[model samples]
Target: MFRRARFAVLFGVIFLVILRYYTTTRHSILDVTEGKTSGPWREEWGHPIKTKQSKGANDTVHDESDEYVNYLRVLHRKHGFTNDVPVATRRIKAKYSKPPLKARPSLAQVKNPLFKDPLGFTRARLDSDNIWLPAHAEIPPLSLPIARTGPRPSSIDASSLLFGISTTYARLTYANNALLSDWAAWLTDGRGSSNGAGLVLTLHGATESQVKTIRDELHHLGIDVTLTASAEGETDAGGRYAQLVQQMMRQRHREPDRKWFALVDDDVFFPCMGRLLSRLQKFDTSETHYVGVPSERADWVIDHGTAITYGGAAIFMTAPMLDTSGQLLCLQYTKTSGQTGLADEEDPGVGMAWDEGLSECLARNTPDIKMDVLPGLFSPTTANAQTNIDDVQRGGGYASGALPLALHRYRNYHRFEAGKGHAVTSACGEDCFLQRFLFKDGWVLVNGYTLTRYDGGVTAEKVTVQTPKKKSGGADSKGAVKPSERLRIVDAEDVNPKERYALSWKGKKKTWRLLDARVKENGEVWQAYVNRRGGGNTVGGDMDDRRPGDIVHHAEEEKSDVDSVILLIWEGEGEK
Candidate 1:
């Protein structure tokens, strides 16, 4: 009996030893299969570092596990997975009108399985800025408030000009409040937008609420916009930029009426949209054309493999160039291979700079297309080279008889600065224009005098006044100089020999009349008082200023000097 009991105990002990060995071997196999067995999971700098692996009994785990891990990583960085998340756009109620339509689902939301929510926020891990979202994959539809509630402007011809501005959410306020406001005033308050013009804004990581805000504030500008989030796992900067280019191409396809398509930074300034369009009219948009001020940093395209289209000022492409198959090829490359070429990589995201990426795209897809360095597109002053706004504008010396197409680096100028009516010290002279008039930037100085009077109108008239002569004891009894009469130049020394000037007088009845005047580069000769009506107000003003020229009143008394000139024209002259 004792021997049998001992045998049973030995058999039990052997079974227990086999069980322990099998368990140890299985754990070791899992360690080898999995990358590495780390410590307990922990958060580091908003990114979740998973240290421990799941010890689940089941082998076939859902792919969502990895996705959830990524989601957690982004969530911690953004909001720490807060349950008290504020419902965006929930408080925006339409009291005067019905609430805006629910935002359309983004392309990524519709196509990518990773983005489950249609319009809801998704953590797109792109760059250190945490900007990209899945919504960036598709282009926003062409949506703009119509003139008579019709489709987008379809009238296309050689004079057609399109403006495409690139911006981001962090800079949204500047774009809408400052830039767009200035643009609208130029279009509505000034005649700069006369030649057919279209504006489009492209933004990234723009939520529905943000889009609604921009649309509501800028509806009157007749501008179209494409606002979307970046793609998921598109950690590379180039990937996000490629997506922007694709959207621009798609926008051009949608609007076939424009001849020239200009891509610019949000801070860029279109001093005079009309003049820019006219200059563009000189170029053939149907041919392959790439226009921009080349950057010094673009020299490394061959060795370091980076090219850039000095985007601070402007980047332009003819409609034909954008319509080419090469652009489509670039689009495909961005979509398939990825914008930054790091979306599918196992390592961290390294985004390509937009300027470099765009340069590469244009070169690779359309090698025949040559990038034209247009010095006129940038401001002559170096201060305006980047997006710096502290100094005179890049194109501040615009009225120096040199018409620049665009000015880069208005980002630093606040709306208040533009409103202060301060002329650029470097550009302004006694009778010379100080700075280019960005209609929104204070008063328009023509020949160093405010173009429009306080009443905001420009009217032409003819007047006669006594010319100023050397005080050679030629004074009347009333202490007025009874000198020979000619024409009056605001300041003879500052006026150019070739340029024309006008003397404006506000009659007792508030009627403004313009008198033509002559100026010589040398202070040898100039007009004292202009008594003849030659040209009308250069800029149109708000409604009530338009009046018949037949109401011209005679000059009551010859003013000593016609310094404060005001153009007496009304909004009726505004075509739109």
Candidate 2:
């Protein structure tokens, strides 16, 4: 009995050791899609089994959890128990740990499976958010030669012209002095004159000293000088100013009798004054009221007017043109309001109002006057009090190709403290609003080679003010201002000769034949006609042969008489 009991104990020990070995060697199968694990077990007959469950229930029924636990126990027996085993109460909870979070898909990942990778996901995110990204590949460098088609014709004449200067102040230290001198010199040079013989200087609000200096300087150069001034504390400075100018003109007009009057501001400079003036002198004004300088701000409402706003500083007006309408033009421009201390703003509604009103008054009051335009003459110059002779030299005098004709120094007076300023520059601010308005009404402006610096005893920087657009409806439907519409014309005006010629062929055999025989109008090809018979049999030969008197189809292209046209003739043989 003792021997048998000992043998049974040895058998149980061996069995336990074998079971632990199998458990340690086996792996657990995890169901990633279901977010769970099948647990660990030993294979029996190619199937996993739980030692405890197999003994208690039918072996055919598999229990994953039971199998897992049994396998753990077997491993503990063979490899020694580890602290990693969970407590009995925590095992169940651990099996159902929070379900794995789902990943969010990107736009590209959703669109293409191949782009489902992380890199593609990043790109898709950036693209969907409208973020800029670097290109994936480097671009090859291009090597091409620039070819000139032909030489352009010169449209401007460089001699014998007149320029005008307009001003409200005539002080020596005013910022426009240097500018005016430069303009005078440029005009003299451009006109090929030894002296500024035709240059007319018109001054407004001239002090006694200022008038004396201007008259003396201009007199020495043989140039005409007209100084207009108002009495101290006058209520109507504009009217007085106008009267003074007229008086000066009458005095000069009665003398040598000048043919043209150049109206210029005291502070205007003329860098290219000579070239522009020379060009102006060559223009035929018999059909126009005035020939104006080219300007960026041109208005369309002024009749016979080209949009080229000139600086009130420098404009060229014919003596006859002004004599005919000068009084009425001055009358219409007369100030209706008392001087307001508001020097920082433009008084469009005050001192001087509608540009159209001024133009209309001139047109109605003077019936024989016409107008033309000069190109590229006037530009605003430095108007700051801090500008000096040195600054003018560094900035290039009015004669510099890029220099502006008119400079405004008025703002410097109000902005910065006096005495602390250096030299004055620019009279009309940077944009020169007044210059634009005048140019739009057909006025000639010139910036000569000389600098006309103003030392108006004030210092200030110009500021831009935005005007709110008026609403069309009530507050509820208010909207921002709409941009003006633009029209584009294309055809012979835009296309080249060779390209235009090829466009005449419409692909239809009949149309092609008609186009081949068409003649050109001016220098461009006119309309073409195509034969319209079903084939060639109805007209003459076989169906394949060309025919006449069938039906005629016209070419798509047509040209006006003023444009150039080409004549086309058929070269190959065809049935008549």
Q: List the RMSD of every prediction in angstroms.
A: 29.2, 37.9
**Top of the candidates by TM-score:** 1
**Candidate 2 on 1-576: residue-level lDDT in tens?**
999999999999999999987775311110110112111111121234333322222122234344333333333333222223221100000011123212100000011111111111111111121211112112111111111111011122222333334444434434324333333333332122333344434445567777677766555433444444454434243333344346545644454444454454443333333334444556444423454332211211111211123223233555555555455644423343433211113654343322223333455656454444332322111112122122233322211222222243312211111110110111111111111000111211111111111112111222322223433331112221221111111111110111100001222221111111111121111111112223211122232222232121123222111111111111111111
lDDT of 1 at 378: 24
Model 1 lDDT, residue 47, Cα: 40
Off by over 4 Å in 1: 1-159, 174-176, 185-196, 224-237, 293-313, 325-338, 342-352, 377-403, 413-576
Give per-residue CA lDDT, model 1, range 1-576, as digits (tens): 999999999999999999886664211111211112211011122343342243333222233234333433343233221222211000000011023212111000011121123323332232222222222223222111111111111212223566665566566564225455444422332211222455566556577777777766555444444445554443344555445555666777777776777665555554434434544565677687766632222221211111223344366778676556334544344445445542323434544455545665666666666665444322211211222121123222322322333444422321112211211111111111122121121122222212222224223232222232334444333232221221111111111111222223343212122111111122111111111121221121221132232112223422221111221111111112
Cα deviation in Å at residue 439, candidate 1?
Answer: 23
